[model samples]
Target: MIEIDTKKLVIGMYVARLDRPWLETSFLFQGFRIENNHQIEQLQTFCKTVKIDEEQSSPLVSFEAFKPSTGRLNGTPPPPTAAPQDQKARFYEDMAQAKSVYDNVSGSLNKVLTEFRLNNYIAIPEVKSCVQSVIGNIMHNPNALVLLSNLRSKHQHSAKHSVNTCIYATLFGRYLAFNPEQLATLSTAALLHDVGEIMLPKTIVDKKPDELSAEEIAQSQLHTQYGADMLRKITELPAEVAEVAHSHHERIDGNGYPRGLKETEITLMAKIIGIINEYERLTNNPNPKLQLSSSDALKAIYALRDSCFDAGLVEGLIKCLGIYPIGSVVLLNNGSTGIVIGMRQDNHLLPTVMIIRDPTGELRHPPKAINLDKFRDKEGKPILLISKVLEVNSVDDDLRDYILAELVTKNKPM
Candidate 1:
């Protein structure tokens, strides 16, 4: 660490220490990136000099100046080191493992949420264990859990939403190269993001904002505050975790509730959870009118870029999920219908698919899975390209049925 005058502070530097004890200030953490002009000003108010951790500082330009990789909205990033040639085979193998992981996590979350409803207490160790398990699985292979999350049961919306949000947030965090500690905190915060809802009456929580009285709307907004208060009472969690629960609802434009914080006032972890939480809700909202398909949700969030979320983080989210995220059903150039089963790091557009219907629109009794990236015609040209994305219910057969069928075939025989 090197001591530097606060006057010399710039964006991207990591402040390790201040001349004064950190507890005296409002800054949440003892160490943090000087991410904006406002933070520099805040530091100047608190300290004339600080110590910088040169190794931890981001070498990239300031968050405001950084640009998302090109051709993203236009195209996918160049393929990572060529993925395994038999990725489809590996995906199924991973799917079986991921299903087991999902079952475990779902059970744990149900217990936690149930406990919170009965008594306002949470078991910190149980949450930490679940977070570690999820992290290990995602780091092993990201596709399996991602695909399973999309198949969440509608009956268990609240519990499953938290689990899916935790997975998505962890995946996004991993894409950003967050350290283990940061990932743990992010995952834990996501797991409990909506915990405050447990405190509200079922009638109020179940109704949509339009159906609610003004008082009901106000009570609903208190979830953020309730969640933050709950976490603060749990001394085991890091302070930032509580901060995320409090500020995830806060928009960059200062229109958000609980606290109308704007831009820099929101912490980075909160921003990450905010983006993922919205995406999850849009895709899985109980109100069908409010629900959006994965592609459309991405577009909606992209439109809010700087005003509601960090632009670079949104781009990171798009990249992590891909143009046609797993579980999206699409029409193929071959006039067939299929569901995206896996993604290729090299090309997001050409994902692996499980063909459920033939060109004649007839259901294929046993769906056939193929890697679009590797499929070729007799002439050695690509055999199929995505013609259009379809709503999950576009086909006569339920999409969930197809996904469950595939999972059953991949997992141990019943």
Candidate 2:
């Protein structure tokens, strides 16, 4: 740790330790990055010197200078046109509409990927069209698509991981307020980020990703180069597509390959894809022994922050998908197994849950919907709270299956 005056701190540096007791200050996070001048000014107001751990610090980034994903100016995020409650309601209302868009994306993207695997020329426009639909779904109300994606986890198609990565990257891009054109490009890059894996030896390509051993991962690194060269050779695709394919494995701390580019040397888009791609791989493994729940996977990524990924972007990821994101099967204080269908922006702890099992673990038909924030006892105390976030695989099979079936048949988790 090095002591530095507040004046010397830059935008992306993670402040490891403060000069004073954390309780004495109003800062919500004990350790954080100086995202804007206002934060630097706050530090300047609070302390003269602070400790910086260089390993955890990211070099200065000017949002205006380079937008890693959007390929455009990173000005202020556009203001929200609708209130938060309206946005939450939109998720429920758009399920049917979102389903149609999702079906189109999965079906068409699969065909394109199949053609690619067969060494047939795949049309760029078809892939772009799928990404366009994803961008639209994300902009409208991401939760419907979010819930659908969670339910579709059982589909077991080869393209499922890529599709999840595309949807999530688009969600994060929308959260970052990328314009439609920028989002189209970002989503397209995300969808094709792993296209090179199709060219690996069938023995390696055929195995579920989680089953790949350490040496197998090393052998597969060439896929990054292959994917980049393949995408770059396509006349119609944008340069960023190739760039992401080439660099998504590149880490900020310089440990990644095949190029081992570090810090700002990796584009913002590549970092975004890297985070999403890894997150998808971590959470979506079909092997029950290997699968991680959404929250568990985020925690794993959190442990590698600054070393493997950007701290701010990692925080943005957690922010985009709340602590117990929708579809997390959780055990509540009342001893019921509930699925998190909606999150409360006001309080991350208390979400809108669909109780699939009764307190005795009996299946509940048309699982009861309860908004924890509003579900109060007669005396007005919060009656039910999430006790723990359960791993999706750990949940009773009967309960998980019932919820998925009901959501599809009834067209709502509620």
Candidate 3:
């Protein structure tokens, strides 16, 4: 019923969920059950020795392997996919347009970073308003969520961070069926989530991973307090906006920085912000050293459910967002590459995609959307199982041109 992090897992506790890699053919493990202290220790030792990095590792067993055993554990079965709901599932074109808009917005936000800082502790009203507007824009145009995922990058400065969080929070608010007013408010809070980072040293903010000392980590932790204080100075903003700004880093398990507040202590909006914040940070492949493939990122979060996130919320995000969240590059089963655009309520797995490039290095024809759910291969099988999800790209590939070229290639005389 309850999930615990693998690190803190105790023996004799009933297993809430069992995880194995999706790539494996079999899921049988002799010691998967932990009924007593000795069994727990053995499992812990086995996990530590062979577990790999939880954040980047794949489940060692497949869903098929674990399916038969779920009845014994009482864990909920994986829900049916959304793909079959539509009479004709077509998603590719919509996602492309969304991604195009997101790329432009992220470009503009990145341009403003020079005006912001982590140590100044100044809440620029203009910047805050800009962030608010961005959230509002996305809320009015729900399709914008596709672009938000792509906007996450290694640069952790306030401008980009605020926009990314706002997009995420707003999308989540929409999924929760909150009205426009509530969604706007959540977006504003997300936009200003990191306004406090201004007080820290630029050296610390931009520190190389290897260069950070214990003191730097402690100093970095103060940004939450600093951000809350900065937001309080804004007289016109809603009062609760500061909560998202303040608690975006606080975890459900009390393992996060600042106050180390647990689930009940953190606001519901703040909890949403925290989940999306970490998701963006980890999935964005922000640091050169920590880039994760889209598949790997999903796997990491799947393992983290309940322990690091709210189970219902996590499932909601996965359902609303789908396997390949926007901005992720995936290799389709038919030897083509595309970027995810958005989820189809009817079919989450076969989302609308923008075919940016082809295996022959050609762009799509007219850069139209391709609905994989309706796309079948020559063999009459679905031709779009995602092979990999692309995250951080140092160069901007002209996705529009790429998509068009792919179509051109497809129609060329054999």
| C-alpha lDDT values of all predictions | 0.79, 0.77, 0.59
Writing each residue's lDDT as its tens digit, candidate 3 over 169-252 gives: 777776786654676678777766776665678888777545789988888888888878877776777777887778877778
What's model 3's overall lDDT? 0.59
1-414 in candidate 1: lDDT tens per residue? 567888878897778678999779877544666778989999999999987755346655342222234345556675354245444455567788788878898899889888877776797888987897788677656777887888754334677889999999988887786876888899999988888888888999777656899889988889898889998899899998888889999888898877799999999989899999999888877766566778988999999999988898899899989999987878999899988877755478789887888999888866777778778778877767999888744643365666676765555321
Compute each candidate's TM-score over C-alphas: 0.75, 0.74, 0.63
Q: Where's the lowest-lDDT run of ten residues in candidate 1?
A: 61-70
Alpha-carbon shift of residue 10 in model 1 (angstroms): 35
Cα misplacement distance, residue 31 of candidate 1 (Å): 29
> What total of clashing residue pairs does each candidate reach?
2, 1, 40
lDDT of 2 at 49: 91
Of candidate 2, the 10-residue stretch with the lowest lDDT total is: 59-68
* Deviation in Å, model 1, residue 346 alpha carbon: 2.2
Q: Which ranges of candidate 2 are over 4 A from the true structure?
A: 1-93, 210-215, 377-381, 396-398, 412-414
Query: In terms of TM-score, which candidate is stronger, 1 or 2?
Result: 1
Best by TM-score: 1
